[model samples]
Target chain A: MNDGTSATVTEIDMRNTSLRDLNRQLHEATSGHFVVTNPRGAHAVAAGIDSDIVVELRGSVGYYAAGMLQRGTVIVDGNAGTGVAENMMSGVARVTGSATMSAGATGCGGLLVIEGGAGARCGISMKGLDIVVGGDIGHMGAFMAQAGNLVVLGDADHHLGDSIYEADLFVRGDVASLGADCEEKEMSAEDVDLLTQLLERAQMTADPGDFRHFGSARQLYNFHPDDINSEVAEARS
Target chain B: MTGENWHQRESYTFDRNVIAEIHRAANTGIYRIRGFGAKRRLPTFDDLVFLGASMSRYPLEGYREDCGTDVIIGEGRAERPVHLDIPITIAGMSFGSLSAQAKEALGRGANAAGTSTTTGDGGMTPEERGHSKTLVYQYLPSRYGMNPDDIRKADAIEVVVGQGAKPGGGGMLLGQKITERVAEMRTLPEGIDQRSACRHPDWTGPDDLEIKILELREIVGWQVPVYVKIGAARPFYDTALAVKAGADAVVVDGMQGGTAATQDVFIEHVGIPTIAAVPEAVRAMKELGAHRDVKLIVAGGIRTGADVAKALALGADAVSLGTAALIAIGDNSPSLEDQYQALGTTAGCWEDYQDGTDPAGITTQDPELSARLDPVVAGRRLANYLQVLTLEVQTLARANGKSHVHNLEPDDLAALTVEAAAMAKVPLAGTSWIPGMG
Candidate 1:
């Protein structure tokens, strides 16, 4: 296991090493900086990492790359497939290129950074995750997002933060449309600080003032007695 | 002058129960939402009876003979497959739906029975995880309270596609049941009627499910078995697809399976019967040439030892229990008659599990109500019930000249009804005729 830059480096060539073997070796290591070469768009390239290690993948990865990551740093030099860094607990997952749908979906805790554009349903059902997207995101981004901070430097697609609860969403560029129970809220000082930290951590050039904050309107949280009455009236009409 | 001499006739078109339901709906302008499975009569295991040994076959002594009930699920695949002393397991019921004491009791009872108990949609609670010896973590659509550490602690993983109570529908935890703890775990506001998603956010259908299963296996290092569970909507194709999706085992829950809360219409009218589901699932597995290679666990309406034996005879590797286990743990107990009446229901007909005012304290979240159910006593009762079921299965197997419970086959059974004969692929009791067989 490599300790620092000067220590012995661990390199795994996916051409020779099996996925299971590679993950097994990674899981066994406590502290190391490993470089993965020739990934060839394989799924689960560096998944279930529970230690404080560094995993750098040279090529594009398939579905669920860096999935269920606990405590580690995952850097993907190329594009990622669906659910990149999905369900990660505590870690730092950075993708240099674009990612497919549901990036960081249902993640409990982690920092997910996508340098390029992301597909639809990005950060869906995100719980306590911090996401910073440098490029534009597709439709249904952060739908039903529970608790998290999503900072987008570029334009966002339609239905951003649909049915959101307690999560803070900030977008720099134009938002196509807001979804149900989502509305633009006045940005606070704390929100600005949070955005500044996330942007600085992601190393993306964007000012906190350039973005607008959006969050839950708290309308769809509970079922009121009037809701049923209105629904019944609508049905009859 | 007496009521008996009044000569009142009930209408066949609209029965009293049906009329009452309509009246209730008209008053509320909403459909009836309740718990429990279908209350209507359906073709069940009671329609088929095992043929005891006659002059053709010699019977073993019931008390002395040893009829084995052990089952090993996910053999040859997982590093640590689930090994059960009995074939019966406790089905998945969420912590948000059931009280902590009830979840603990289920785990404790399953432990005593030397079987496995599964965690449900709301994720694994510390009470259940600590109490259960063998636990199967359910990976559901909502992904509520899902933690990778809990997944690592599980003995097995169950990817829940659907439940039998409502096949195409999702789960519902009403506002009353969503307490502070429940809300915190689900990452939602308190007192919200949480409607869980019907499909996974990242994946859809079998092809994507295969990849999802791979990710799950990778998370756990392929140490434990992974089972895919499906509601009995399309048993044959669902089973085939689940097998093709690389499941170590398949759990098929039929129409009679219980739910914590669902629309009455969906519960009663959604899926096929348990007796019909088993044969079709077995057929699919047999055709895939993975009949015993991939184990099958059947659920829904499995109440007695006879039901367990019947499921095995129809080619199920094991069976799971939800409603019956709750009953054993004091749900709908006759002792709570006064309380049940106060809630506008009878002891045997208590189906207001969604309201969360359960008299027996098994379903409610109220501290005072939840305190009434003693976990130790309830667990012992469930253990006793499981023991009785196992004994009865062994007795039937021995009487049928079988050395093991799994050895009981369809040839050793006969149907009491034409519908049963056709569905079960068995001969009629007195006649040598099966409806579709030439």
Candidate 2:
């Protein structure tokens, strides 16, 4: 617990260290503040970190920089690569800069906040995580998203939220095009209240009234029993 | 009757099946899709003959001496490596392709034989997992039913880059097989055909694959072994790359391996034969000095105990069975002849496994059809078959005067045909000369 001593952050130099050893050490550690310096675009930096600690990575990173993250505060000082925080279950991942494709993809639970623009397929196949993107998002944003809330302050590129399910998508700026089965819906007062809280968590400023909400139409897959036309056909046959 | 004396001459280039395939393709405008391995005849273990000890070495007693059969997979990598009583392990077959009972049967049989069984494409089933003492969960390109929790529950993880039947092609689970449970697990609509992606979503090349292995190792705390399985397109390079990618075990699958669904053309045309594939993989391991250190498991058409013995003698640490395993679980039993007749196919001749109307109940998802085969009986049958195979291997080893099954080598074998001699790199019978060797 390190309760006996004053909380001291452990500094690690990433220039000559192995990521395998680094993640292993992180998994074993119960409580401590960790600072990773000179990441130098390392892939899988602090990956699979599951302890209740904090990690500050000080550089642009490569793919899966903080993948499958759980119970930690991971802050990337610069731009992150593909699949950053991918499949993360819990805790927080705050990126000071932008992220590449599939940012926060397939994450179950967590708060992933990107300050700058995100590349294509942001929040793809999201399970339950809440993502707040400050700037623009590229094509196919939240494609096939199953669950979670994606809030984008800036523009969204083509085919946003294609074949989405359950997940709610909110964009403030212009959308190039909407994808199949994803349609705009009336934003209730409840949505605005939720957006305001999420923005406050990300520490970003944006008017909740300006955002437009979009979600699945459930045309291909009907959630209700009465909506199953094929089952009825089979029953009649 | 008089005109029948003049029979029509058939062209050798365009045979009956070729003509039928062309017409079928023309009619359907799609390739012929089916299940099972290559139907065409190819060079196999039958071309090879064992050289029993006569005078040069004394043969061991029939029942007195013990020939060690126990094999330890993932020697240095895994924290808890699997200890197999025999060298034969059950190959991965998905739950969607085979009924849950069939999966359970495979697990029970492999477990009873003191070996391992693997899970394939659609993910782990509780019945299969519960029965299997040692289970290898396959992580495929599609990632269908893939989650971190299932990966954690597995004893070993096999990263499947390719399968033998469709090396460059994707996996196809037909609409008929897409039961409600399968649709839910794969996140697809019910009664719709599904195709697995050819490439992994996250990573790309071999370099990236190496990183993925490292990530998996870290995620599992290095407790379970990570295996890389590849089709036998180019065994030497593929085995070398898999070794370079830091695999605990490397599995090479030849053309004769079965699939749930694939194009018949691909099954017949793609990939090398098992006999041709083994030596190249062995050569790669030998070149890298990783022969025994990193385990080698060969699959495809490994049916009998002699096949297992031959694969081991050819430098593989173990062998895997898929089609044979299905047969053990009563896939084409003669007892199901009445049902097979109703399905319009003879027993042991059914290849339309993709249609999901299997009469034997091993490959069907229909509740009534799947209920025909009992797991306990099927499992016992498979266990008996495995025991016989193990005994046969032990007999061959004793005949060669080898004290252990692993000690069986090329010196105790010779090939009958020139191609077999060249492929197997063994001397021709009654001669000390290998065809290609100087």
Candidate 3:
């Protein structure tokens, strides 16, 4: 079971195994390292792993890879489809290649490191999951993000962090436009330190000072009668 | 004109309610938000009447004969299908929308009745899970308070696509109801207006939903059933899509379904009636050859056992109760008339659930108001109500010469109005003609 690493290894070939058996085994294992080969864009690869195990998918994964993962480590060596690591609670999920829409969506607690770019809504509705992207992210990134830290090493597309709450966004390059209620803020020493630590964890060499911070304006938290008409008009446009 | 014979004319379009709403909108510059279902009437189960057995078919003895009320949901697909003592079950209502005591009572009652209770938009709470024998966890668009550990604790999982009151809109919990505890669970600031997302954050469409269902199945180890719940917008298509998306059961909620907080306009104007939606959903399920295998639970405006029986006859496997269940738990009680009047409304007509000043304590976050409700007492009331409903259904089924409630079919029913006949696809009373059949 040993595969050069100190931990015991369990090898699973996706071509020969059913998705059910793979996840069931992962769920039951208390502690082990799982090496999955030939994932080949299969959805929900390594989803719902609750135990404190480590899973490494060798190839591309389809939608919801490592979804709702808890107390585990899932590393996808290739590109990920939509909603990778979605709603993950307390785990580490890494995508070596780019991820599609809603990566790390609604995650309560976790660390998701994407070595490449991400699609739209990269961290939509994210809660307390730290996502570090090595490359640029698409529009509407971090939309309505509740609580989390999202760090993008490259430029961001338009309308980032629409209707966000509490979540912090740090981007290094130019952003097309800010979303409703999302605004750029001056980077403080704390922001710098947080970004620096995230970068080091993701293994991306970027100066924390180069990144600008963004957060919620908190204007839309409650209903305001006076601003209703204008906000509605803005939404329509 | 005589002193007592004077008359005043009023336009139907500009009625008193309309005038008041217009004035309120003009003054506030905001739409009216409230709770409860549609106030306007539509063709409903009340328009349908069951035909008891006569000389040709012998009826079972009303009190002496046994008529089964038990139902099994998620039979074929799920490893453990839910077994209910009655065909009626409680629908999803959030902990944030209701008091914790109210949630606990619902669980306690459902447990006593041998049925299931569902968790709502706010996610599963310990009170609900601890009290109920069977609990269905709702996977909402918000994912607020959603975690893997809680998902594993559930007996069933319901993927909420939409609600009946506002089919295409998100959920609304006004600032007044968002207490410190609610805020912590939902990861939001206390006393802020909360708007839950309309569409799911991760997936969209049936194709994506299929994958989503698979993920959930994997999460629960395929031990619990997965139900896809849709507001009855386009029931036929939605039911078919849900079946194709790998649901063990389908829940169709019509326009008459209740809400904790929603715009008054949306509640009245959107979606079809419950009776209208059922037949179409049934047709789709039958067409897919997945009719009974994938159980159907219909909701909205289901008050009496007659409504439940009619729904079953129209091809529903079971019926869910929302507003009616709240009534059973003492919401809008006439005993609280004085307090209701203090809030500028009568007890029976009160709909300002968004205000968090509920006199009955069923729908408020204020500790004092919530404390007015005793969980044990409320639970007993709900259990008694459930027992009465079950007895009524049994009486009707025995009269129809059915051994079980599920045996009642469309042939045993007739509609009173032409609209009802057309919508329910049943023949009109005293006539063989069904308006839409020809």
Best by lDDT: 3
Give the per-residue Cα lDDT of candidate 3 at B305. Answer: 91
Any runs in candidate 1 off by more than 4 Å, and if so which?
A1-7, A225-237, B1-11, B436-438
| Worst 10-residue lDDT window, candidate 3 chain B | B1-10
Using TM-score as the measure, name the better of candidate 2 and candidate 3: 3
CAPRI category for model 2:
incorrect
Instruction: List DockQ for all candidates.
Output: 0.46, 0.18, 0.53
The residue ranges of model 2 lying beyond 4 angstroms of the native Cα positions read A1-21, A29-34, A38-40, A50-54, A70-73, A100-112, A117-237, B1-7, B432-435
| Candidate 3, lDDT over the whole model | 0.92
The local lDDT score (0 to 100) that residue B52 gets in candidate 2 is: 88
RMSD of each: 3.4, 5.1, 3.9
lDDT for B104 in candidate 1 is 91
- Report the error of model 3 at residue A73, Å: 0.7
TM-score of chain A of each: 0.93, 0.91, 0.92
Please give the lDDT score at residue A229 for candidate 2. Answer: 47
Model 2 Cα lDDT, one tens digit per residue, A1-237: 233144688777777667766777777777788888898888888777777888899999888877878778899999998888887878999899999988987777789999999999898877678999999999989877777899999999999998787789999999999898899988999998998999999999989999999998877452122324455577899
Provide the DockQ value for model 1: 0.46
lDDT of 1: 0.91
Residue B238: error of model 2 in Å?
1.0
lDDT of 3 by residue, A183-232 (tens): 99889999999988888877889889889999999998999775555666
Give lDDT tens digits, candidate 1, residues B174-209: 989999988888888888888787878787789888
lDDT of 3 at A54: 89
Off by over 4 Å in 3: A1-6, A226-237, B1-8
